[model samples]
Target: MLIPITREKFEQLIPLIATGPQYAYFWGKLPMVLKRLLISVVALVVIFLLGLAFGEGFYFFRLLFSIIAGLYWFWGPIYWASRRNLEIRRYKYSGFWRGRVLDVFVTDEIVGTEETVSNRGELVIVENRERRLNVEVGDETGFTTIMQGPLRRTHKGIAEGQVVEMLILSNQPDLGRIAKTSDIYIPRLNIWVSDYPYLQRVIFAQVSSQLSEAEERDYPDNRAVINRRRRR
Candidate 1:
Protein backbone atom coordinates (compact mmCIF):
# COMPACT_ATOMS: atom_id res chain seq x y z
CA MET A 1 0.00 0.00 0.00
CA LEU A 2 1.18 3.55 -0.70
CA ILE A 3 2.38 5.28 2.46
CA PRO A 4 3.40 8.84 3.15
CA ILE A 5 6.32 9.92 5.32
CA THR A 6 4.91 10.89 8.71
CA ARG A 7 6.26 11.13 12.24
CA GLU A 8 3.64 8.81 13.71
CA LYS A 9 4.12 6.23 10.97
CA PHE A 10 7.88 6.35 11.32
CA GLU A 11 7.64 5.27 14.94
CA GLN A 12 5.88 2.07 13.90
CA LEU A 13 8.70 0.72 11.75
CA ILE A 14 11.23 -1.61 13.38
CA PRO A 15 14.99 -1.18 13.32
CA LEU A 16 17.42 -4.09 12.92
CA ILE A 17 20.56 -4.01 15.05
CA ALA A 18 23.52 -5.31 13.13
CA THR A 19 25.49 -8.06 14.84
CA GLY A 20 29.01 -8.52 13.63
CA PRO A 21 32.63 -7.89 14.45
CA GLN A 22 32.83 -4.85 16.66
CA TYR A 23 36.21 -3.20 16.55
CA ALA A 24 37.55 -0.84 19.20
CA TYR A 25 35.13 1.84 18.11
CA PHE A 26 36.85 4.78 16.39
CA TRP A 27 40.41 3.92 17.35
CA GLY A 28 40.25 0.30 16.24
CA LYS A 29 40.72 -0.91 12.70
CA LEU A 30 39.66 -4.30 11.44
CA PRO A 31 42.52 -6.73 10.95
CA MET A 32 42.53 -6.20 7.20
CA VAL A 33 42.48 -2.46 7.53
CA LEU A 34 45.37 -2.61 9.96
CA LYS A 35 47.35 -4.68 7.48
CA ARG A 36 46.77 -2.15 4.76
CA LEU A 37 47.75 0.70 7.02
CA LEU A 38 50.95 -1.08 8.00
CA ILE A 39 51.80 -1.71 4.38
CA SER A 40 51.20 1.91 3.53
CA VAL A 41 53.41 3.04 6.36
CA VAL A 42 56.23 0.78 5.26
CA ALA A 43 55.93 1.94 1.68
CA LEU A 44 55.83 5.59 2.69
CA VAL A 45 58.86 5.18 4.96
CA VAL A 46 60.82 3.51 2.20
CA ILE A 47 59.94 6.28 -0.22
CA PHE A 48 60.86 8.97 2.29
CA LEU A 49 64.26 7.41 3.10
CA LEU A 50 64.97 7.10 -0.62
CA GLY A 51 64.13 10.79 -1.08
CA LEU A 52 67.02 11.76 1.22
CA ALA A 53 69.60 10.64 -1.34
CA PHE A 54 68.16 12.97 -3.98
CA GLY A 55 68.71 16.04 -1.75
CA GLU A 56 66.78 19.16 -2.84
CA GLY A 57 65.83 17.56 -6.16
CA PHE A 58 63.28 15.30 -4.36
CA TYR A 59 61.79 17.91 -2.02
CA PHE A 60 58.49 17.24 -3.75
CA PHE A 61 58.69 13.58 -2.71
CA ARG A 62 59.33 14.49 0.93
CA LEU A 63 56.43 16.96 0.91
CA LEU A 64 54.15 14.39 -0.68
CA PHE A 65 55.14 11.83 1.94
CA SER A 66 54.40 14.31 4.74
CA ILE A 67 50.95 15.07 3.35
CA ILE A 68 50.21 11.40 2.79
CA ALA A 69 51.33 10.48 6.29
CA GLY A 70 49.28 13.24 7.82
CA LEU A 71 46.19 12.17 5.93
CA TYR A 72 46.74 8.53 6.83
CA TRP A 73 47.21 9.16 10.53
CA PHE A 74 44.36 11.65 10.87
CA TRP A 75 41.85 10.71 8.22
CA GLY A 76 42.42 7.07 7.39
CA PRO A 77 40.89 5.49 10.49
CA ILE A 78 37.84 7.71 10.34
CA TYR A 79 37.28 6.72 6.73
CA TRP A 80 37.62 3.05 7.61
CA ALA A 81 35.15 3.35 10.46
CA SER A 82 32.62 5.09 8.25
CA ARG A 83 32.81 2.34 5.65
CA ARG A 84 32.65 -0.38 8.26
CA ASN A 85 29.54 1.27 9.63
CA LEU A 86 27.94 1.05 6.21
CA GLU A 87 28.70 -2.65 5.99
CA ILE A 88 27.32 -3.22 9.47
CA ARG A 89 24.19 -1.33 8.51
CA ARG A 90 23.93 -3.44 5.39
CA TYR A 91 24.15 -6.57 7.48
CA LYS A 92 21.27 -5.29 9.55
CA TYR A 93 19.29 -4.39 6.44
CA SER A 94 19.66 -7.91 5.09
CA GLY A 95 17.11 -8.98 7.67
CA PHE A 96 14.77 -5.99 7.39
CA TRP A 97 11.05 -5.99 6.65
CA ARG A 98 9.39 -5.81 3.25
CA GLY A 99 8.27 -2.54 1.73
CA ARG A 100 6.99 -1.07 -1.53
CA VAL A 101 8.08 1.79 -3.67
CA LEU A 102 5.91 4.84 -3.22
CA ASP A 103 7.85 7.46 -5.15
CA VAL A 104 11.05 8.04 -7.11
CA PHE A 105 12.90 11.27 -7.84
CA VAL A 106 16.27 12.12 -9.33
CA THR A 107 18.67 14.23 -7.36
CA ASP A 108 20.80 17.14 -8.65
CA GLU A 109 24.18 15.66 -7.77
CA ILE A 110 26.21 14.13 -10.61
CA VAL A 111 28.58 11.24 -9.86
CA GLY A 112 31.14 9.93 -12.25
CA THR A 113 30.61 6.50 -13.76
CA GLU A 114 33.34 4.35 -15.24
CA GLU A 115 33.60 1.35 -17.54
CA THR A 116 36.29 -0.95 -18.96
CA VAL A 117 36.22 -1.34 -22.72
CA SER A 118 37.10 -4.63 -24.39
CA ASN A 119 40.28 -3.45 -26.08
CA ARG A 120 40.46 0.02 -24.62
CA GLY A 121 41.58 1.54 -21.34
CA GLU A 122 39.11 2.54 -18.65
CA LEU A 123 36.35 4.88 -19.83
CA VAL A 124 34.83 7.32 -17.40
CA ILE A 125 31.81 9.60 -17.67
CA VAL A 126 29.79 11.76 -15.35
CA GLU A 127 26.28 10.54 -14.66
CA ASN A 128 24.28 13.74 -14.38
CA ARG A 129 21.20 11.97 -13.06
CA GLU A 130 21.05 10.43 -9.61
CA ARG A 131 17.81 9.17 -8.11
CA ARG A 132 16.19 8.68 -4.69
CA LEU A 133 13.11 6.80 -3.54
CA ASN A 134 10.49 6.79 -0.86
CA VAL A 135 9.24 3.41 0.27
CA GLU A 136 6.37 2.19 2.46
CA VAL A 137 7.07 -0.71 4.79
CA GLY A 138 4.83 -2.31 7.42
CA ASP A 139 5.12 -4.61 10.38
CA GLU A 140 2.83 -7.52 11.33
CA THR A 141 0.62 -5.08 13.18
CA GLY A 142 0.12 -3.43 9.77
CA PHE A 143 1.66 -0.17 10.92
CA THR A 144 3.67 1.37 8.09
CA THR A 145 6.34 3.99 7.54
CA ILE A 146 7.57 5.73 4.41
CA MET A 147 11.36 5.84 4.27
CA GLN A 148 13.68 7.26 1.64
CA GLY A 149 16.83 5.85 0.01
CA PRO A 150 19.21 6.68 -2.82
CA LEU A 151 18.72 5.07 -6.22
CA ARG A 152 21.79 3.75 -7.99
CA ARG A 153 22.14 4.11 -11.74
CA THR A 154 21.11 0.46 -12.05
CA HIS A 155 17.72 1.24 -10.55
CA LYS A 156 16.84 3.77 -13.26
CA GLY A 157 13.91 1.92 -14.79
CA ILE A 158 12.27 1.23 -11.40
CA ALA A 159 8.76 2.64 -11.37
CA GLU A 160 6.68 4.02 -8.56
CA GLY A 161 4.36 1.63 -6.71
CA GLN A 162 6.62 -1.34 -7.36
CA VAL A 163 7.24 -3.83 -4.57
CA VAL A 164 10.38 -3.00 -2.60
CA GLU A 165 12.01 -4.44 0.48
CA MET A 166 13.67 -2.22 3.04
CA LEU A 167 16.47 -2.60 5.58
CA ILE A 168 16.34 -0.08 8.40
CA LEU A 169 18.49 0.19 11.49
CA SER A 170 16.54 -1.25 14.38
CA ASN A 171 18.79 0.00 17.14
CA GLN A 172 18.96 3.68 16.44
CA PRO A 173 19.77 5.53 19.64
CA ASP A 174 20.02 8.93 17.99
CA LEU A 175 17.38 9.26 15.27
CA GLY A 176 13.94 7.79 15.78
CA ARG A 177 13.62 6.59 12.21
CA ILE A 178 16.17 5.72 9.54
CA ALA A 179 16.16 3.75 6.29
CA LYS A 180 19.41 2.02 5.42
CA THR A 181 18.84 0.56 1.97
CA SER A 182 16.03 -0.35 -0.42
CA ASP A 183 15.89 -3.20 -2.91
CA ILE A 184 13.56 -3.31 -5.91
CA TYR A 185 11.92 -6.59 -6.75
CA ILE A 186 12.09 -7.38 -10.43
CA PRO A 187 9.66 -10.16 -11.25
CA ARG A 188 11.17 -10.85 -14.62
CA LEU A 189 14.65 -10.99 -13.15
CA ASN A 190 13.29 -12.73 -10.06
CA ILE A 191 15.82 -11.12 -7.75
CA TRP A 192 16.35 -8.08 -5.54
CA VAL A 193 18.89 -5.53 -6.71
CA SER A 194 20.32 -2.49 -4.98
CA ASP A 195 23.30 -0.22 -5.49
CA TYR A 196 24.51 0.15 -1.97
CA PRO A 197 27.56 -2.12 -2.08
CA TYR A 198 28.84 -4.29 -4.90
CA LEU A 199 29.62 -7.10 -2.49
CA GLN A 200 26.04 -6.87 -1.29
CA ARG A 201 24.80 -6.96 -4.90
CA VAL A 202 26.88 -10.09 -5.41
CA ILE A 203 25.54 -11.71 -2.25
CA PHE A 204 21.95 -10.98 -3.27
CA ALA A 205 22.63 -12.27 -6.74
CA GLN A 206 23.85 -15.58 -5.35
CA VAL A 207 20.94 -15.94 -2.94
CA SER A 208 18.10 -15.47 -5.40
CA SER A 209 16.10 -18.28 -3.80
CA GLN A 210 15.86 -16.22 -0.63
CA LEU A 211 14.21 -13.58 -2.78
CA SER A 212 12.13 -14.43 -5.89
CA GLU A 213 12.35 -16.43 -9.12
CA ALA A 214 14.04 -13.82 -11.26
CA GLU A 215 17.09 -14.91 -13.25
CA GLU A 216 20.58 -13.94 -12.19
CA ARG A 217 21.76 -10.79 -13.92
CA ASP A 218 24.86 -8.66 -13.76
CA TYR A 219 25.11 -5.64 -11.50
CA PRO A 220 24.22 -2.21 -12.93
CA ASP A 221 26.24 -1.18 -15.91
CA ASN A 222 28.49 1.87 -15.62
CA ARG A 223 27.93 2.25 -11.91
CA ALA A 224 30.81 3.11 -9.63
CA VAL A 225 32.06 0.17 -7.58
CA ILE A 226 33.31 1.65 -4.36
CA ASN A 227 36.49 -0.13 -3.29
CA ARG A 228 36.96 1.38 0.13
CA ARG A 229 40.34 -0.25 0.63
CA ARG A 230 41.57 0.73 -2.81
CA ARG A 231 40.31 4.25 -2.30
CA ARG A 232 42.61 4.60 0.69
Candidate 2:
Protein backbone atom coordinates (compact mmCIF):
# COMPACT_ATOMS: atom_id res chain seq x y z
CA MET A 1 0.00 0.00 0.00
CA LEU A 2 1.31 3.44 -0.98
CA ILE A 3 -0.21 6.70 0.25
CA PRO A 4 0.75 10.05 -1.28
CA ILE A 5 1.81 12.46 1.45
CA THR A 6 3.86 15.62 1.07
CA ARG A 7 7.41 15.73 2.46
CA GLU A 8 6.22 18.33 4.97
CA LYS A 9 3.55 15.89 6.18
CA PHE A 10 6.16 13.15 6.43
CA GLU A 11 8.29 15.34 8.70
CA GLN A 12 5.20 16.09 10.78
CA LEU A 13 3.94 12.51 11.11
CA ILE A 14 7.42 11.12 11.72
CA PRO A 15 9.31 13.87 13.43
CA LEU A 16 13.08 14.20 13.10
CA ILE A 17 13.32 15.03 16.82
CA ALA A 18 13.09 12.47 19.57
CA THR A 19 10.02 12.19 21.81
CA GLY A 20 9.23 11.47 25.50
CA PRO A 21 9.44 7.67 25.56
CA GLN A 22 12.83 7.83 23.86
CA TYR A 23 14.17 10.10 26.61
CA ALA A 24 14.36 6.99 28.79
CA TYR A 25 17.12 5.71 26.54
CA PHE A 26 18.93 9.04 26.79
CA TRP A 27 18.73 8.83 30.59
CA GLY A 28 20.87 5.70 30.35
CA LYS A 29 23.60 7.93 28.92
CA LEU A 30 23.45 10.41 31.82
CA PRO A 31 26.41 8.88 33.61
CA MET A 32 28.60 8.93 30.51
CA VAL A 33 27.40 12.39 29.45
CA LEU A 34 27.89 13.90 32.90
CA LYS A 35 31.35 12.37 33.11
CA ARG A 36 32.34 14.06 29.86
CA LEU A 37 30.68 17.31 30.85
CA LEU A 38 32.79 17.45 34.00
CA ILE A 39 35.96 16.84 32.03
CA SER A 40 35.11 19.62 29.58
CA VAL A 41 34.36 22.05 32.44
CA VAL A 42 37.76 21.28 33.96
CA ALA A 43 39.41 22.11 30.67
CA LEU A 44 37.55 25.44 30.56
CA VAL A 45 38.79 26.38 34.02
CA VAL A 46 42.34 25.41 33.16
CA ILE A 47 42.27 27.40 29.94
CA PHE A 48 40.87 30.48 31.71
CA LEU A 49 43.64 30.37 34.35
CA LEU A 50 46.22 29.95 31.60
CA GLY A 51 44.72 32.91 29.81
CA LEU A 52 45.10 35.02 32.98
CA ALA A 53 48.75 34.01 33.23
CA PHE A 54 49.41 35.15 29.64
CA GLY A 55 48.67 38.81 30.73
CA GLU A 56 49.73 40.56 27.46
CA GLY A 57 48.32 37.71 25.30
CA PHE A 58 45.17 37.22 27.46
CA TYR A 59 42.86 38.40 24.58
CA PHE A 60 44.30 35.82 22.17
CA PHE A 61 44.11 33.02 24.73
CA ARG A 62 40.49 33.94 25.58
CA LEU A 63 39.52 33.66 21.93
CA LEU A 64 41.30 30.30 21.72
CA PHE A 65 39.35 29.03 24.77
CA SER A 66 36.07 30.17 23.26
CA ILE A 67 36.81 28.28 20.06
CA ILE A 68 37.55 25.07 21.96
CA ALA A 69 34.41 25.44 24.06
CA GLY A 70 32.22 25.84 20.98
CA LEU A 71 33.89 22.84 19.34
CA TYR A 72 33.31 20.69 22.45
CA TRP A 73 29.50 20.93 22.02
CA PHE A 74 29.68 19.21 18.64
CA TRP A 75 32.23 16.72 20.01
CA GLY A 76 30.17 15.86 23.10
CA PRO A 77 26.90 14.07 23.92
CA ILE A 78 24.83 16.08 21.40
CA TYR A 79 27.06 14.75 18.61
CA TRP A 80 26.34 11.15 19.59
CA ALA A 81 22.58 11.79 19.91
CA SER A 82 22.42 13.57 16.54
CA ARG A 83 24.19 10.71 14.77
CA ARG A 84 21.82 8.15 16.30
CA ASN A 85 18.79 10.22 15.25
CA LEU A 86 20.20 10.55 11.72
CA GLU A 87 20.35 6.78 11.35
CA ILE A 88 16.62 6.70 12.07
CA ARG A 89 15.81 9.57 9.67
CA ARG A 90 18.32 8.31 7.04
CA TYR A 91 17.95 9.16 3.31
CA LYS A 92 15.32 11.32 1.67
CA TYR A 93 12.23 9.15 1.57
CA SER A 94 8.98 10.09 -0.19
CA GLY A 95 6.36 7.34 -0.36
CA PHE A 96 4.83 5.78 2.74
CA TRP A 97 4.36 2.10 1.88
CA ARG A 98 3.01 -1.11 3.35
CA GLY A 99 3.69 -4.69 2.35
CA ARG A 100 3.09 -8.28 3.39
CA VAL A 101 5.62 -10.36 5.31
CA LEU A 102 6.97 -13.18 3.19
CA ASP A 103 9.12 -14.92 5.80
CA VAL A 104 10.36 -14.74 9.38
CA PHE A 105 13.79 -15.93 10.54
CA VAL A 106 15.27 -15.63 13.99
CA THR A 107 18.88 -15.98 15.16
CA ASP A 108 20.99 -15.31 18.23
CA GLU A 109 23.98 -12.97 18.07
CA ILE A 110 26.39 -11.21 20.43
CA VAL A 111 25.23 -7.77 21.53
CA GLY A 112 26.63 -4.98 23.76
CA THR A 113 25.51 -4.61 27.37
CA GLU A 114 24.07 -1.37 28.78
CA GLU A 115 26.56 -1.14 31.65
CA THR A 116 29.28 1.50 31.26
CA VAL A 117 32.84 1.55 32.60
CA SER A 118 34.49 4.86 33.52
CA ASN A 119 36.49 6.92 30.99
CA ARG A 120 39.99 6.58 29.45
CA GLY A 121 38.96 4.08 26.76
CA GLU A 122 36.53 2.19 28.95
CA LEU A 123 35.81 -1.50 28.53
CA VAL A 124 32.71 -2.61 26.60
CA ILE A 125 30.75 -5.55 27.99
CA VAL A 126 29.20 -8.02 25.58
CA GLU A 127 26.39 -10.54 26.00
CA ASN A 128 26.58 -14.05 24.58
CA ARG A 129 23.16 -14.32 22.93
CA GLU A 130 20.74 -11.69 21.70
CA ARG A 131 17.84 -12.82 19.55
CA ARG A 132 17.34 -11.00 16.22
CA LEU A 133 14.41 -11.38 13.84
CA ASN A 134 14.85 -11.01 10.08
CA VAL A 135 11.47 -10.49 8.38
CA GLU A 136 11.27 -10.28 4.60
CA VAL A 137 8.47 -8.08 3.28
CA GLY A 138 7.35 -6.87 -0.16
CA ASP A 139 5.24 -3.93 -1.40
CA GLU A 140 2.90 -3.73 -4.42
CA THR A 141 5.83 -2.81 -6.63
CA GLY A 142 7.27 -6.32 -5.97
CA PHE A 143 10.28 -4.87 -4.14
CA THR A 144 11.35 -6.94 -1.15
CA THR A 145 13.76 -6.34 1.75
CA ILE A 146 14.64 -7.89 5.06
CA MET A 147 13.82 -5.82 8.14
CA GLN A 148 15.76 -6.71 11.30
CA GLY A 149 14.95 -5.87 14.91
CA PRO A 150 15.53 -7.21 18.39
CA LEU A 151 13.31 -10.07 19.57
CA ARG A 152 10.98 -8.49 22.12
CA ARG A 153 7.41 -7.61 23.11
CA THR A 154 4.67 -9.20 20.96
CA HIS A 155 7.13 -9.42 18.06
CA LYS A 156 7.36 -13.20 18.48
CA GLY A 157 3.80 -13.51 17.17
CA ILE A 158 4.69 -11.75 13.89
CA ALA A 159 4.50 -14.38 11.12
CA GLU A 160 4.48 -14.84 7.37
CA GLY A 161 1.68 -13.22 5.30
CA GLN A 162 1.07 -10.44 7.79
CA VAL A 163 0.89 -6.76 6.76
CA VAL A 164 4.10 -4.77 7.28
CA GLU A 165 4.67 -1.11 6.59
CA MET A 166 7.55 1.40 6.43
CA LEU A 167 8.78 4.60 4.80
CA ILE A 168 10.01 3.99 1.21
CA LEU A 169 13.18 5.76 0.08
CA SER A 170 13.47 5.57 -3.68
CA ASN A 171 13.91 7.93 -6.64
CA GLN A 172 11.33 6.31 -8.95
CA PRO A 173 7.75 7.34 -8.10
CA ASP A 174 6.60 3.78 -8.55
CA LEU A 175 9.09 2.85 -5.79
CA GLY A 176 10.78 0.24 -8.04
CA ARG A 177 13.83 0.19 -5.73
CA ILE A 178 13.91 0.49 -1.94
CA ALA A 179 17.30 1.84 -0.87
CA LYS A 180 16.40 2.53 2.78
CA THR A 181 13.52 2.13 5.25
CA SER A 182 12.21 3.67 8.45
CA ASP A 183 10.56 1.82 11.34
CA ILE A 184 8.27 -1.10 10.44
CA TYR A 185 4.65 -0.97 11.61
CA ILE A 186 2.29 -3.92 11.83
CA PRO A 187 -1.14 -2.31 12.21
CA ARG A 188 -3.10 -5.48 12.83
CA LEU A 189 -0.81 -6.48 15.68
CA ASN A 190 -0.32 -2.86 16.77
CA ILE A 191 3.39 -3.60 16.91
CA TRP A 192 6.39 -1.74 15.56
CA VAL A 193 9.94 -2.97 15.11
CA SER A 194 13.05 -0.90 14.59
CA ASP A 195 16.55 -0.39 16.00
CA TYR A 196 15.43 3.07 17.12
CA PRO A 197 12.23 4.97 17.94
CA TYR A 198 11.70 7.15 14.86
CA LEU A 199 7.98 7.79 14.58
CA GLN A 200 5.67 9.98 16.61
CA ARG A 201 3.60 7.10 17.99
CA VAL A 202 0.53 9.11 18.94
CA ILE A 203 0.28 10.90 15.61
CA PHE A 204 1.20 7.82 13.59
CA ALA A 205 -1.47 5.75 15.32
CA GLN A 206 -4.13 8.26 14.24
CA VAL A 207 -2.87 8.23 10.65
CA SER A 208 -2.31 4.44 10.47
CA SER A 209 -6.03 3.74 10.76
CA GLN A 210 -6.81 5.97 7.78
CA LEU A 211 -4.08 4.32 5.69
CA SER A 212 -5.27 0.84 6.63
CA GLU A 213 -8.83 1.77 5.56
CA ALA A 214 -7.55 3.17 2.27
CA GLU A 215 -5.60 -0.06 1.74
CA GLU A 216 -8.76 -2.11 2.28
CA ARG A 217 -10.54 -0.15 -0.47
CA ASP A 218 -7.62 -0.62 -2.88
CA TYR A 219 -7.58 -3.60 -5.30
CA PRO A 220 -4.94 -5.23 -7.53
CA ASP A 221 -6.34 -3.54 -10.66
CA ASN A 222 -2.90 -3.36 -12.25
CA ARG A 223 -2.21 -7.01 -11.49
CA ALA A 224 -5.52 -7.95 -13.13
CA VAL A 225 -4.64 -5.93 -16.22
CA ILE A 226 -1.24 -7.66 -16.48
CA ASN A 227 -2.86 -11.11 -16.22
CA ARG A 228 -5.45 -10.30 -18.92
CA ARG A 229 -2.74 -9.08 -21.34
CA ARG A 230 -0.69 -12.24 -20.75
CA ARG A 231 -3.76 -14.37 -21.55
CA ARG A 232 -4.39 -12.45 -24.80
**Using TM-score as the measure, which candidate wins?**
2
Candidate 2 yields a Cα-based lDDT of 0.67
lDDT of 1 by residue, 53-99 (tens): 88888898788876776457445645655565455444322333444
Off by over 4 Å in 1: 1-82, 85-96, 109-156, 172-179, 182-195, 206-208, 211-232
- lDDT of candidates 1 onward, in order: 0.44, 0.67
> Which candidate leads in lDDT?
2
Model 2, residue pairs in steric clash: none
Q: How well is each residue in 1-232 modelled by candidate 2, as lDDT tens digits? A: 6765666767775555555545444434555566666777777888777788877568876877767774563355444545566664554556777678888888887755455575777876656467998888886677788878788868878887777767766655655666667678877778888765667766777676666555445745455643342232
TM-score of 1: 0.35
What TM-score against the true fold does each predicted structure earn?
0.35, 0.65
